[model samples]
Target chain A: MCATCGCSGNEHKLTAFLAMKKPEALTGLTVATLPPGARPGVQSFAPDTPVKTVIELERDILEKNNRMAERNRGFFEARNILAINLVSSPGSGKTALLERTLADLGARRQFFVVEGDQQTARDAERIAAGGAPVVQINTGKGCHLEAHMVHQAIRQLQPTTDSIVFIENVGNLVCPSMFDLGEGRRVIVISVTEGEDKPVKYPDMFRSAQLCVINKVDLLPYLKFDVQALKEYARQVNPQINFIEVSATSGQGMETWYAWLGL
Target chain B: MHELSIIQSILEATTNAVQQNGKPGTVETIEIEIGELAGIEWSTLEFLWPAAVGDTLLADATLQVRWVPGKAVCSDCSSSFDVRRLYDPCPGCGSHLLQITQGEELRIKSLTLVDKPTVAKAPLRWN
Candidate 1:
């Protein structure tokens, strides 16, 4: 079982790949000694070696995920749906912010949520309480939600056209930034308690995000978190990233967030 | 960590490549390119490489990685520079508006497969 999420660790096993392996034939193979300090992109083999064949494959490692993400993008565009991916570290208040948004704008807008967590359907339950259809994806041992996962969730939710879909990705600062879920906008949330240097520490997440939501502003006075420094640091990484400060509990800056959402 | 997942993807891609080549005996070497800004830690990837490929076809494969440096062009000044971090600013105008020209590459460049040798035919005995 996974120590972090309390689920079996084989959730992400690609069965097709596993099944493709043939029994090993370990006989009659000549092992050549490679030159010391040989590197890729440099010629390391002799042309006369008839036993070896080099296959050139300039393939992207994330090509499969990228293609799936593009398909999801096309699906969302054809239906005129706006999909937003919410990403952040654990306890950055992504679900809380979504709850406030669904509660405040449910009457004015059609909202659907695809909540992602390593375990439990608690976030989905909270989203359902707000009257918007929701689908919960338990990633098991998977650290981040990939495009195919989101595609499956979208299918299960069956959100209507001209609606908004919020994909609350598994709360991770690093891994989730590597996978694109075909969201129209990627938002990174940071709370006052997490400190101002988060952007610099996790530049990849900050750089990929289009918007930065500074949560828990009500506790700003109690902590020494410098909001300006955080914005400056975030801008240093991503100059075009927008910011919205809010306290979901007190509804401090929910209006600005709503306006940013155009709801 | 995510490096394990990345390695899994690498193994899967390599496995598919081998299958496409009519099930080459074994992967001898796998060449890959990883950019400086690909959001991967080299140490972490290297650390997890052994165990991730232990049971796969790549278990005995020589893993070769080509490191690509991050490069970006300043949108404001049209100046190009090598980037070490995402927060790097334009040297010409000190502006943060920059367009990434290169880096962020995570690719499998090539694979070398060794075919098993055929059994030697016995010379006909002359009586």
Candidate 2:
């Protein structure tokens, strides 16, 4: 019985063909060409012959991606670059806050932006308007930007040493939490329009974040959202979570926000 | 969802294992260990496994996912306990400082393959 699809046994076949019609490809190739376990000395069994064998390979599934992330971290450390991963849900004003940040601190420090989205270079354009080099990575169907994508973006942007690279992750509260993009710190941005329970609702994102920016505090008087309650909820999820309330529109509390970034 | 991508990874890992050890037959069983904190949906993985592994060496392979429970150690009290959620506090100390020791596992443990049987004929009487 086919456990996955409930298909009968007659259709599913495990037989594979390793046809090397061009033997020269094999002769000239080094050990790198073979799949990990099929190294030259390590035995490779044919799938056509009937012999019961168990292959023991205790390997981490995310190890490859994590290794790439470590490589990115090494790159960042070597260059003395402060990489910050900005995560939040859609319409959380991440872009507006970033715009204010670049304009206010542009003269003090160099900035590079790695904009991630499912479509459009719109965010990249906005960041570039603020006089920073930006690389936009369209993830297509991917929900989050992986470390490798950020590494590629860094190669393209090549921000100078001691510069700050802000990686604006895809507007997702869940998927981006599991991915480590070699950032020195993770900042989660939330707006006043969002519910105070957002931290508890998406505990993973809040717990992984080092700082939380409660954006759009200027509208606090008109809205029913309680800022203190939101902070308390966030703290309940992450005891070490630091907060900065700001409004990108009115430029409220942006100084403290910049100060947190050591700008 | 990202489940599709994860399934692809699992398929790639399985293929590598099969190519290394499978003996000219079919894969019988594949055992994978997934922890509670791996953030994968079990039903979604089960739904996508068939289409993802179809036409590959992992076709018809029995996928056995061993779910590992999340375990953590409290930094303040040094008490070990189960972690049901990301924000779960230490039972003894109520501290958020926790070092997760397990349950983030996403690994392929082993695979069983049945190769083509090599039948032995009676030894030749005449030399």
Candidate 3:
């Protein structure tokens, strides 16, 4: 039975990735390791008098995640950390954009990145090459980055107060939107090569994001994507959403993007 | 698949619910409420139920999922209405500034369990 809620069940599994060199830095840090669930049959037995009992437990299944998210939120608030969760589909140029951002302001500002992927640490390597302290989280079989994982990553990174921390979620549009990593802001990246109606198709992602970045704009001259129509579609879903078009490769409209970040 | 993980969570939660009651009995019925905006596919969950609970305490337990439709309220005009999708606009004001009032629920409602036999059912002799 769960101590928080009177539910008797196995614990949901999670995997946390942290590489400690000295091992002393790990002191005081309680890493939530997600190591890795099924159904069973019913056995009926003769009872003297069958007693049927109904237990009312209006417990939210996702409550555990939410509770961890609140803790993360408090941690960020106490430290004055600006944690941004960047989400989008695979190949949406999330890493490319991050590389550019790091290369541009890495020397001026102390930025720490928590890179989430299903398998490799390639993205983390790229961010490090671009001149930023980065940690890689490999969520094997897990579709999205849960708050508990982020909390562990934060403890490992130990980002400086008032510094910027970017949580590049696994390239998924659906599941990442549902799980909040206690980010100060959520930015959804959409490329011109993708369908313009993505906002409508993935309404939850667009609705939850505070900003929508239209990446790969340099390819706009070649591709037949309607930029205005895409923005209009996004607005139909979230009236208060902000947008910025940029080409991470050509550095086009990067200043505007940086300005929005208040760097 | 994410659905697989969701099934695991359900099984774990149900098991916990059963143990807390202090009665030895396999689960008879497990009821859960999932809202439309909760981002779960009902058919998929239903399809994965059997394999998920194959040999656990709830193997023969009946699974009941109550789907709650998405609903929202218009922040601009204070209009309450049912929302089919997150992008739905206010019916009265047609404003995108709508606050979600309901839906997006994923919870374990209740569990029904049968008492397990503690001793043989033979008639008790007068003491």
**Highest DockQ: which candidate?**
1
Cα RMSD, each candidate? 13.6, 12.0, 15.3
Number of clashing residue pairs, candidate 1: 0
Q: In order, what lDDT does every prediction score? A: 0.86, 0.83, 0.82
Local lDDT at B24 for model 2: 63
Q: Evaluated with TM-score, which candidate comes out highest? A: 1
Q: Model 1 over residues A1-263: C-alpha lDDT tens digits?
A: 64423446523211111111223422332333344344332222222223677889899998888899999999899999999999999999999999999998999989999999999999999989888999999999888999999999988888889999999999999999999899999999999999799998999999999999999999988999999999999999999999999999899999999998987
TM-score of chain B of each: 0.89, 0.86, 0.85
Tens-place lDDT per residue, model 3, B1-127, is 5566677777777778778888887688888898898788777777888998899987988888888988888888997999988887888988988888778888989888877444322222232
* lDDT per residue (tens digit) for residues B1-127 in model 2: 6777777777777777677753566778888999897778888888888888889878878988899999999888999999977778899988888888998888989888886533222222232
Writing each residue's lDDT as its tens digit, candidate 2 over A4-57 gives 234464343332223333555534422112344543333232222245778887
lDDT of 1 at A136: 94
lDDT tens per residue, model 3, A197-246: 99999888999999999999999989999999999889988999999999
- Per-residue lDDT, model 1, residue A250, is 95
lDDT of 1 by residue, B1-127 (tens): 7788889889888888888888547788999999999988999999999998998899989999999999999989899999999888898899988888888999999999886432233232333
Residue A8 in candidate 3 has what lDDT?
54
DockQ of each: 0.37, 0.32, 0.32
Could you tell me the lDDT of residue B127 within candidate 2?
Answer: 20
